[model samples]
Target: MSYNKGWRYIAFLSGFVGLLGVTLYPIAISPMIDASEYKKIQKEARKNIRQEDIQPGNMKVWSDPFGRKKPDSE
Candidate 1:
């Protein structure tokens, strides 16, 4: 009975530790992984961006449909 109890306690402790590691692993590692990826994306975006793309002069003015003259109703 003592041997069985000891094994049971070891098994329970192992399972608890495993679950705690699994829960904390992502919390510890995700920010580091995400920060690196975010930096990589920022660099790529900056490299691919063109000066004209950011200029407001290239933008078209929005036309309002309500401001247009309606065709003469027959």
Candidate 2:
């Protein structure tokens, strides 16, 4: 019973220390962002997309109203 009590105290103290470390982590770290650099990257990505990459019609597998695609040959 004495040995069990010592181990239980150690476990409780370790758990409390772990909880304190997790609570303090975000306060110890900082993140940096550059707005102009991010905007330039976003503009480049937008310009890279072409008009032909998208198909202009919505077709369902169960039914087709416009008959845009042929049936599968399987």
Report the C-alpha lDDT of model 2 over 9-59, residue by residue, as the tens digit: 899889999998888765553212335666788888889675455535643
Which candidate tops lDDT? 1
Q: Report the Cα lDDT for candidate 2.
A: 0.67
Q: Which candidate number would show the highest TM-score if scored against the true structure?
A: 1
Write model 1 residue lDDT over 1-74, tens digit each, in one string: 44547779899889999999899878886766678877888898899777566868776445575788778999
Q: What is the Cα-based lDDT of residue 59 in candidate 1? A: 65
Off by over 4 Å in 1: 1-4, 30-35, 38-74
Compared to the true structure, candidate 1 yields what TM-score? Answer: 0.39
Off by over 4 Å in 2: 1-4, 29-74
lDDT of 1 at 5: 71
Listing every candidate in turn, what is its Cα RMSD in Å to the true structure after a full C-alpha superposition?
Answer: 11.7, 13.0
lDDT of 1 at 66: 72
